[model samples]
Structures are given as C-alpha cells and as structure tokens.
Target: MTYESSASAFRHLLEARRSIRSFLPTRVPDSMIASVLQDAQCAPSNCNTQPWHVHVVSGSSRDRLSQALLAAEAAGRMSLDFSFSANDVHGIYGERLREQGAAYYQALGISREALAERRAASLRNLEFFGAPHAAFLFMPVFGDAVRVAGDIGMYGQTFLLSLAAHGLGGVPQTVLGMYADTIREELGVDPSLKLLFGISFGYPDATSAAAAYRIEKVPFEDSVVFHN
Candidate 1:
C-alpha cells in the first residue's frame, strides 16, 4: 500500500474500533483467532518484557466458567489482585465514567432508578455478554506491577484492533478480574500470574442495543495542553 492508502487504512481501523458489549452465539474460526493473535504479538511493551499471559475460553469451557462466575458473584466472592473502583476517581474522570454508564443503561432501556434491572444488565459481563469466546489476560508481578499493567494494556489494544480488522469485535471486562481466584482455579493458571482483565469476543450482534451505542471521547482540547 502507498503511504496515503496505508495512513488511511490505519486511521480507519483506529476510528472503527470500539467496545462491543453484545455478541452472537456463532463462534469464530480457530484459524481466524490464530491470525489475530499473531498480529497482536507485534504490540510493543515496556523494555520488551512481554508479561501478558492470555487464556482464551470457548465452547463448553466458556459456559462452565460463566456458571462459576455467576455462583461466585451471588455469594459475594471477589478475589481482586488490584484495587479498582470507578467512583474513586474525581472531577472530569468521574464525570466521564458516569456518562459512559448512563449511555450504556439508556441504550439498554433500563432506567437509572431500576436497581434490579441495572444489576441484571451488569451481570451480563459475567456471561461474556453472550459471546462465544472469552480471553483472560494475566501478568506476572514485576516490581510494583504498574509498568506491567501498561504493557498489558498495549497488548490488549493490539489484540482488539486485530479483531476489528478481521471483521470481529470484543469488549474488555474489568468485572471479570474481580473473580480472579475463581478464574485461575478453573483455568488452571499458574498462581504466580495475577489477573488483570478479560476480553469477550466474537461476531457482534448488530440487532442488539449495545451495537447501536458508543461512548464518545472528550474533546481534544480538554485532554491535551500544547507545550510547544
């Protein structure tokens, strides 16, 4: 591809990529998954430590994990390796978070005052939003784990982008990390690896409410201050 074409394609991919909350039951081909994983391997990391360990669950295993997650959630069992709470953020960050949640709930046609409905909607994350596959991302603790987290984020973006390029979609679920102990035990992951987050992926359900909604980014001026 020429410079202009390459730049256009790259920009298109970046702009087209977004979180897909609901997916169809059809599973993606294993070869396609392999291709996306291969492309994602090019993601850059801090000092190239390459600390991400991803386990992709599908078919019966995926359904079984969903059951286990539901049981753990019902019993209030949350085994988090890192602290995370959106409400803890203040100012613009908190406002943005709230805005996203409102948009999502609105799309689902669930009123903010409907606590039970909202809870049920949120619980969909445990079922991987009905996607046929889920990928749990884990990392070995290195130092404070801050740097490792950043590295994994890059890896995740790359993986998501690759999925988009292949006509697939995915959503990253932090809620899944809350059941880290359950996930590790079910997947037989090494004890040393700490859960970060997970990605639910497959063909997006275009007829679903989530497919019609998106959380727009804030203005460029609000995010960047020119130093030059």
Candidate 2:
C-alpha cells in the first residue's frame, strides 16, 4: 500500500477502536492471541527494557481468577499495588469521568439512584463481561513512575490496537488491579511483579447495549498546545 493509503487505514482503525464491555462467550483462537501479543511487543520502552510481563488466562483458569476476585470484593479485601483515590480524579478529568459513567450506565439501563444495582453491574468486571479470556498486565518497578508506567501504557495501547486490527475487542479494567494479591495468588505470579491492569477480550456482543455506547473526545485544540 502507498504511504497515504496506509495512513488513512490507520486513522480509520484508530477511530473504530473502543472499549468493548460485553463479549460473546466464544473463545479467541490461541494462534490469534499470540499473533496480537507479538505485534504489541514492538511497542517502544525506555532503554528497550521491555518491562511488561503479561499473563493471559482462559477457560478454567479465567473462571477461577474471576471467582477469587469476586470473593475479595465481597469480603472488602482490596490489596492494591498502587493506590487510587476518587478525590484524586477531580477537575476536568473528573467531569470527563462522570460523563462517561453517565453514558455507560444509561446504555446498560442502570438507574442512577439504584446503588445496589450499580454495585452488581460493577461486579461484571469480575466475570470479564462474559469474555472467554483475559490478560493481566504486570511490571516491575523501574525506580521511577514515568518510565515504568509510560512503557506499560504504550504496550497496552499497542495490544488494544492489535486486537482491533484483528476484529477482536477488549476492555482495560483498572479496577481489576485492586485485587492484586488475589490475582497473584491465583496466577502464581511472583509477588514482586506489580499488577498494572487486566484486559478482557473476545468477539464483542454487538447487540449488547453497553457495546453501543460511545463517548465523544474533547476538541483537539482544547488538549493541544501549538507553538509556531
């Protein structure tokens, strides 16, 4: 393909990609999953450390991990490798978060006043929203937050884009990282490897209401600073 054609195709792919909340129960082939991971391996990292340690789970293992996570949530036992606070998500970021939540809940037909229902809905993360597979991303601390997290973020974006290119869909759930201890115990991962997040992936359920929701991006000028 010509450079212009390739650029246009890439732009289209970026526009088409979105977080898929509901997935069909059908499993993605192992070969395809391997291919996507291989593509994501090309993501650039500081000093070429390639610090990502990914664990992909499926079938019985996936189910067991989900159960453990749900049990931890029920028991109020959250052991996070990294702290998260709702108060930290304020200002324009908070507004964007609220808007996204409103759209998502509305699409799922969840009532804003129904606290129990909302909690139940959130529990679907544990089930991977019916996905047949999931991948938990882990990384070791590299002495600085910027280098470690920036590398993982790029790796994750490449993975997601690779999925999109293959006509698969996935959702990155930070909430899954809250049960870090449970996940490490279930997966038999080394305690030193910190959990970054989990991605649930498969063929998307097109008819699901959650799959229909889309949030608009802020204007480019609002986020970019141009200097001539």
- For 1-228, candidate 2 gives per-residue lDDT tens digits of 999999999999998789999999999999999999999999999899999999999999999988999999999999999888766999999999899999999998998998998998899999999999999899998676668978988999999999999999999999988999999999999999999898999999999989889999988999999899
lDDT of 1 by residue, 98-209 (tens): 8999999999999989999999999999999999999999999988999999999999999999999999999998999999999999999999999999999999999998
- Whole-model lDDT, model 1: 0.94
**Worst ten in a row by lDDT for model 1:** 214-223
User: What are the runs in model 1 whose C-alpha is more than 4 Å off?
Assistant: none
Clashing pairs in 1: none
Local distance difference test, each candidate = 0.94, 0.93
Q: Assess candidate 2 and give its lDDT.
A: 0.93
Q: For residue 67, give model 2's deviation from the true position in Å.
A: 0.4
All models, RMSD in angstroms: 1.0, 0.9
Candidate 2 residue runs with Cα over 4 Å from true position:
none
